[model samples]
Target: MPGSLEPLDLGVQIPYHFRCPISLELMRDPVTVSTGQTYDRPSIESWVATGNTTCPVTRAPLSDFTLIPNHTLRRLIQDWCVANRSFGVERIPTPKQPADPTHIRHLLTQSASNSNPYPTRLSALRRLRGLARDLDKNRSTISSQNSREILVQLVFADTGSESSELTHEALALLVLFPLPESDCAAVASNPDRVAYLAQLVQHSSMEVRVNSAALIENVLAGSRTAELRAEISNVDEIHQGVVSILRNPIAYPRALKIGIKALFALCLVKQTRNKAVSAGAPETLINTLADFEKCDSERALATIELLCRVPDGCTAFAAHALTVPLLVKTILKISDRATEYAAGALLSLCSASEKSQNDAVAAGVLTQLLLLVQSDCTDRAKRKAQLLLKLLRDSWPEDSVGNSDDFVCSELVVPF
Candidate 1:
């Protein structure tokens, strides 16, 4: 027995037509899509679940979103599984079919109906969430059937009540599943949505706030008009909500990321930048950097660089002690892109105020700049670092440009 030959790793090959087009796995519960192509149930449902309205194999637009079960094919697949059992292939279990559209429609009507029982509404919401979770085809059905309005309505109702449970589920679905452009535009038209979302940021739980921020980001990204976003971020409450999330020590990393991205989007307006600085974005940014991993620091620095272009931005960033040193650390260390931001931020500070220039020099920014210019950073970073270096040398003539505690640069030929 010890000298017996071992079996090779080669396994049985299944028929090409029997394999799912998307996942290339044996189709356990094969289903025919609107495009008339067959795919495994979960795989096809997932394709539609991602908000796509097309068939994976056919690449044809799905005018019909319904999925038709292939009972005959499934039986054949089962027979194959049984035949291949000796080859170590197990039978693929039958997957439960998604709820019928009529059932989903009835639940939607009941949930949106004014006189529906609260318990019934909760049950319908749970069932709707389940339907949404099961199939991408269902998302198309929901969106096309006007149930997106109901989902949005539920998210809008996410008050600090028992109904918040429903809202949380609804919010996840809206963000995870892509909303129709019309749906996003419809929500954007509602002027109160901004303040409404901000209230959640202030008073809601961390999950709700994150969902709200993501929704806002999504809505903003889907818009066609600058006027829409300008009006959205101009409100003090909305601006503060975004900054508060940035400064929120306990906010999840995703919340912080979306919040900063939202803030960046809002700061495109000159009026909003002043509001962001007034809302204490600079200090919060400094605190964020102290604990941020490399990725977060790049985001924070990019925001700082953007804000630093204005006079008030320079004032706010210069007032913070970690602003200069942090910029120095991020340069030539985190990433070339971050180094570019760091250099741009330094240039803004030194350009706006003489005191900031001297402070940057004292923070070993000069040596960092020399290293940054010599390092394999972007052309923009090298140029900004060189400009800031010249400005520092001209302003503080006696202060050695390279002879700092961080590094000596007497022999370092910094290209002027």
Candidate 2:
């Protein structure tokens, strides 16, 4: 009943031709196939995309796949909607035609053409970006036209008088396109391109910086070889830029997630792990964890787990005043993945530092660890919880643990 199109109760008679044959809804962006019958663009595109070759209304075998826009019908629909405004009908907007490959190729050429004036080239770039953003078909068309290579050249090779402005525009478009792993690998393998990327991440503009961070995350995730990942991770400029992105109070949430994921990938390398720890990754994550939701909390906590592997990372975790309480508070509170990461981070800290163990105890980690052991957390998390329970109990005198019988009895039976 909810999806029914019978408007008889609304006191307005609707024309039969205004409705799509497939969906029985008012046709928006009507288009006709070779069979001379019209359908809504989305409905017909979906029908064709599913491998149906015949017209839905006429049921005739289709010869041409071209969908000609039925402008007359669309105009009539708009006029009818305007006249029926009191009946709650709204006018549908005119749809732009999808940019074909030939047009996309022309725009690509104009954007990269040296003979064109700076404004003309930039205008072409902006137009192409608009097309890319308009539809998935346009994005695929632009990508198929070798847009990535041109954009890469703009960001890395061009040093023209307006290179910076052009580079930012190209970078924005590049981020929109789905970059292949092979292309990303090729870019990451070059030291000069990597250096340029480092500078771009630290760009004066927030949009540029956010785009650069996203691009780096993509490249880091796609880099096939350890050597390539290490090559990018070891750069002080690159890792520091990523850390600074996390530090920015006004950085977009997407940018923060990208920065955290990128830092996590970089931390896969031993040297980069040290660099991230030194850059205050633990402290920054601790400060931000309060505001993060389940998934982001899991990611931030996981990075903190990776950081706690080294002695200095453990020290950094302890040095942050909120670190122990945050880790203790996170256990059994967020998702199970988050619980595991937080437990793992706390175990690392408690195992390394007596002061951290005492701090964890003071923060009431015993109650959290006891709850973790009883809950249905992961086996790995349970093991860490058990270890933390034993570690905390062993670190304190029997008299200091208080009269909490459940906390003391947790160590007697393994949750396993």
Candidate 3:
């Protein structure tokens, strides 16, 4: 009835039963209520959500508004649409079975109890994964079951085999969902779980690795309790996994950003800086910054700023041959913020010894500072650079240092 024959374009006529009583459109996710009438799930849900007690069709005082799935009718409707594809009717997909808390608990229990190899356990994990990913209700359903411990056990369980196909699947489910904070904490709870993530960061597919790093970073940012924060920080492998991301040359830019954020978060706690340094964080971050071939300078610089906070962190930076040079190179070449952070790192690293001070001068930092004082850098950066310039000028070997006018603060290329 809605189509126009004169224009020679007539849409297929939809059946009345296929139409929702409230919305007057083809039913998607159709459900039957107590009044024996079917309607689209969203419309009925909205009607009930608004506190209406009576059924739309019957106006009856429906004591029970349970939305029973109209599966048989849904199947027939899908079949009809498929049969009439030539009429421009698109087949509806088989809707995912509605989430059941009972079923989720049962699957989790089975997942825990089964001692069989991965095939049997994988089946339940796959089902649980599907339900968790398909809808928010399912995610809430699984979360309410307090499934984190179960998931962690499955994920970190020692399979003893080389191929971790099932572990990877479970990891994917854990990382790819909007899970509860408590659930995410379980991933960082113990050394074994943290080790699993570190291993994944090294060997798993890019998606899984990225998600793993991100999950660690997220937990760092928003873990619920103080004890949980301490627990997460104590795991050394979490730091290793984050460092590995920056160390990986083939990682994508977004993954690299997430990795840098993890470092930033991890570096906030004083106790964790030693773990980061032990994880080769300084070297990995230096390489990441120097990888002009494919790098994110903004986050790289910010992470370096955080890493330099620890004394051992500074020692690590100074030990790396390229660390000072890379920080100097980033000045004025990348963003102004990078320039500020680069200046900050130099201040932290070279401010102590006469030899390190001279090394900063040799690294073209003096020239960069002169330019920074005059360039469009941030005010904070300009002030710091000027202070460093004064420090270097005072510390310059006056006898052999050609002339005060030679270091006369002209704009130079900064020796990137």
Candidate 4:
């Protein structure tokens, strides 16, 4: 015979100590054992009283035996126990392993060559995207040199691709990778890396532009004097390019938003500030705000907010009075979600002086904010309204009141 062993029937002769006493087939909640036999509640109590808990078949001693639990059965009992216990503890699922990078590259290669089935390629790419994020999370598991190599590969892959979506995904991974500050410094210092990022900012894809903007922001935040000076030397040309794109009617909304944020950040740097201002940046922003064709209301609002920070620029334009009124109208016309936030910025600028306060009151912002307080809106709006009313009350000349007590009673009431 090729393979033959007679099956032995030990069902009748098996020792009680060797056989698992718990019902292997019909196991239920939290069952315990005495000796080698399993018992339900009533049987257990009877066994304890009679002292006859040895297995009925084997006659093995029942006393002083271990209470070994079936793993699966114990889980069910644990669930019931938890429900009856304290509410503080919580059970969580374990995390899984990240996908392999070599697998990802294989899928990408297959997708490019059209060698694999379309559906499989797409599925593999999706998995690869997830794996990239996971790898970013566990970046510390890899050596710094390896991490840098991977980052460089991603940068190359992102910029070399004609597919906008894939490039955006690759660029996104750059942000997700948790590099140490020193590594960031190294990236910024490396000429090749800087050139690679600068080129990506000019990519045709708006997603690439946005991600590049974020990369630039992160890099510049810790840039050294030499690097900063190099960037500053090119400020006018860069600002003009970015501002042109921002002014373009066909530019993506997200791209324009990022460009505006990046511009604002650049303007905050002392080396870039004067150059940007001299490049007719202020006039360009004012023109954007005035343009009805642009449909960049959010960009316009951001520009206004950024302009407010540069007091000299706001003053130089002779548009201080117009700023508050435009802001108020924009607030009223826009959704209520950002209304109070817009109002707060306007108030901050206008309330800086008694003259400006008078200008704001004349703009009817005070009455508008007061009406907002009466409406059922967010607590933020109500708080802003209260702040505006207080500012208005405080702006009145203190010497104008003969007695402080009268002013207190008339203007503000206090309850005991």
Task: Say which candidate scores most in TM-score.
Answer: 2
Q: Give the per-residue lDDT digits (tens) of candidate 4, residues 279-314.
A: 565656655554432334554555455555565555
lDDT of 2: 0.81
Q: Compare the candidates by lDDT and give the number of the best one.
A: 2
TM-score of 1: 0.69
Window of ten residues with lowest summed lDDT in model 1? 1-10
Global local distance difference test of model 3: 0.72
Model 3: which residue pairs collide?
Answer: none
Q: State the C-alpha lDDT per candidate.
A: 0.73, 0.81, 0.72, 0.51
Which residues of candidate 3, in runs, are more than 4 Å off? 1-164, 184-211, 224-227, 251-255, 292-296, 373-379, 395-416
Listed in order, each prediction's TM-score against the native is 0.69, 0.81, 0.57, 0.44
Report the lDDT tens digits of candidate 3 across residue range 248-346.
Answer: 656576666777877777777766678988899888888767563323577677667777877878888888888777888778987888888889888
> What residue runs in model 2 are displaced by over 4 Å at the alpha carbon?
1-30, 50-52, 56-59, 70-97, 159-163, 251-254, 373-379, 395-416
Give candidates' CA RMSD values in order. Answer: 7.3, 4.4, 9.4, 17.0
Model 2 C-alpha lDDT per residue in residues 1-416, reported as the tens digit of each score: 22114344677777889888998778888998999999988899899989999999888999988889999999998898888777766667888878877888988899888898989888889999999889887887898888998887777764323337888888899988667788788788988788888887777777788788778877877788888888788778777788877876554766676777777778877767888877777788887777666776788888899899988888888899999998898888889999999999998988889999988888888878777777877878888887777777766557756644464366644555
lDDT of 1: 0.73
lDDT of 3 at 86: 73
TM value for model 3: 0.57
Number of residue pairs clashing in candidate 1, backbone atoms closer than 3 angstroms, sequence gap of 3 or more or interchain: 2
